[model samples]
Target: MEQLIKELESRARTLRYRIVKMIGPEEKGHLGGSCSIADVVTALYFHKMRHDPKQPKLRTRDRFLLSKGHAALVQYAALAECGYFPLSELDTLKELGSRLQGHPDMMKLPGVEANTGSLGQGLSIASGMAAALKLDGLDSKVYCVVGDGEMAEGQIWEAAMAASFYKLDNLVAILDRNGLQATGRIQERFNTNPVREKWESFGWHVLEIDGHDFAQIIEALDTADQVQGKPVMIIANTVKGKGIPFAEGVASFHNGTMTQEQFARACQLLEAEECEGR
Candidate 1:
């Protein structure tokens, strides 16, 4: 178990490295949310999800939707790491004619299941996919990662209600509860406290875990598979701008800029940790 966790941790660091590389000092991106969900995404793509990089559209492959689409860089990093596309293509991120856009585009990318970034809509999309798969009698599961800030959206609950009504047990939504949003703390902005209770009231199974912990993430996902008669919601407590000291828990870094020195320092810090772990 320790060895497995170490491998996942290393993959998370690599994903963070890719994120830093793609969103360089010259470009501003959703660094905080992306970093916050790095471990979760890493566990999914590298350890949990049944996906094939070479055959991204395979019907039997599990579907993953980044409902908090602003954090698409993390997903892109995982995809590139998974060999969905050449890592070199990531250099053109957010550029014109680049498949890697500011938000995920299902039509443009192979691994992206839904066109996201409008926020609050990806859950509904995932519910529909889950329902469709159920109707077709396919056991493929749908994994949707949502932002706690996006929980402010009315549509999320609506989708939550629908998932329960349909008993979409195959649908598992992981909430990135980093406590901070674009402007500031979620409570100061639009508090979505009692997140677990709210999802439970919606008639879904609820689980909470440390989002950055591979062991807990893996366990929660495993438990979700055994849950029946309802969809599962994992409320993951995470630190914003995780893995980088300057950015961790700093709300301003939600979409903050990085000076050349800051960027270099961030890179050095992450690399240093990776080396020490080795």
Candidate 2:
């Protein structure tokens, strides 16, 4: 178990590094949100989820949807690492005609289950997929990653209510409560406070935890698996731009660019974290 945690931690750092590299210097990207959820995304693709890279559409395989699709960088990194496509393709992110776009495109990417990024719609899509899987008698699970700011969407609550009403236990929604969004702090923009109570009121099995801690993340996922009725929502408290020293909790980095020096320093920080784990 210790080894697995260490490996996952190391992999998370790698994913962060990939995000930094993908953005490079002076090229804007969704760095903050991507880094904030790196640990959870790492835990899913590398540890918790049952998926096959070689056969992305394999029946009975679990599905992952990045509803907060701006952070598609993290998912792209995971998919590339898992060999869904060439690692070199990451360089073409957001480029004209590139398969790796700013937001997820299920038709362009093999491992991506749905085209996301509009906010508040991912949970709805995931709920439908979960329902379909259940109807098919498949024990597959569907996981959706949503941003705290995105929770303001009315569709999210509707989907939440529907999931609970239908008892879609096969669906799990992980909330990246990083506290910051593109413009400013989520509280300053659209305060979605009392998240836990709200989710509970909507009839979800809620689990709150430190998003960066692999132990808590894994345990929450395991606990989520045992939830028999209603969907599970794991509210992961995280820091925007988590591993990068200068960017942490800075709202500008939500979709900001970096200087060459900043980029180098980000890589160094991520490398140092990976080495520390070793």
Candidate 3:
């Protein structure tokens, strides 16, 4: 476990640096939401999730659904780090004919379970998977990462209720509460202030923490597993462009192009963490 944590931290830093490098010239992709959840996704792909990069379709493996598909870059980063494919494939993201589409395509990408970009439906899919695993007597877990903005969709609640009804303890939902949508802040857009209370009311084991902290990510994931009878939700508080200087805590950078200057500055910041786990 200790060695795995060290490796995951290194891969996370490497991913951040590479994401900064991959932005701008290589399509200047969705840096905001991607950077926001890099740590969480890194921890999952590297340490927690039981997935095989070599044989992605292995039936008994755990599943992860990125319901907030805007952050495909984060998945791409983690995928490359975990050896799903060569790191070279990430530059083809969002390009025409590229397997790495703007969102996940399970058929194309190794280890991806859901081809999700649409909001609110991923939780339902994950719930179904969780129930199916239980029915089949499989011990696999299902994890779905959804944005706080996506919580506005009613389907999420329906899925939540269904999961609780079946006592799907194998399912876990994570809400990336960076709090910004395409237009503005989530509060101004839809107002999901009492998020934990809402989830708890619907019958979920909920935990909140700073999403960027590695230790918090580890502890939350562990606790989510030890929990009994109900599914779990980890509400991760994060900055939009977490490691970037100007972009950090700002929403404008959420889905915009990164100028050479901006990209350069971002790379420099990520470089400081290069020797993080050395």
Please give the clash total of every predicted structure, in order: 0, 0, 1
Give candidate 1 regions above 4 Å deviation.
none
Write candidate 2's Cα lDDT for 1-278 as tens digits: 89998999899999999999999999999999999999999999999999999999999899999999999999999999999999999999999999998899999999999989898999999999999999999999999999999988999999999999999999999999999878998888889888999999999999999999999999999999999988999999999999988999999999999999999999898888878888
Model 1: weakest 10-residue lDDT segment is 20-29
Q: Each model's TM-score, in the order given?
A: 0.98, 0.98, 0.94
Weakest ten-residue segment in model 3 by summed lDDT: 20-29
Full-model lDDT, candidate 2:
0.95
Tens digits of lDDT, candidate 3, 16-80: 77777766642456778888888899888878888888988888898888988878888888888
| Candidate 1 lDDT over residue span 177-196, tens digit each | 99998899999988999898
Q: Give the clashing residue pairs of candidate 2, or none.
A: none
What is the C-alpha local distance difference test score of candidate 3? 0.84
TM for candidate 3 is 0.94
Query: Pairs clashing in candidate 1?
Result: none
lDDT of each: 0.93, 0.95, 0.84
| Alpha carbon RMSD to native, model 2 | 0.9
CA displacement after TM-score superposition, residue 67 of candidate 3 (Å):
0.5
Where in model 2 is the C-alpha error above 4 Å? none
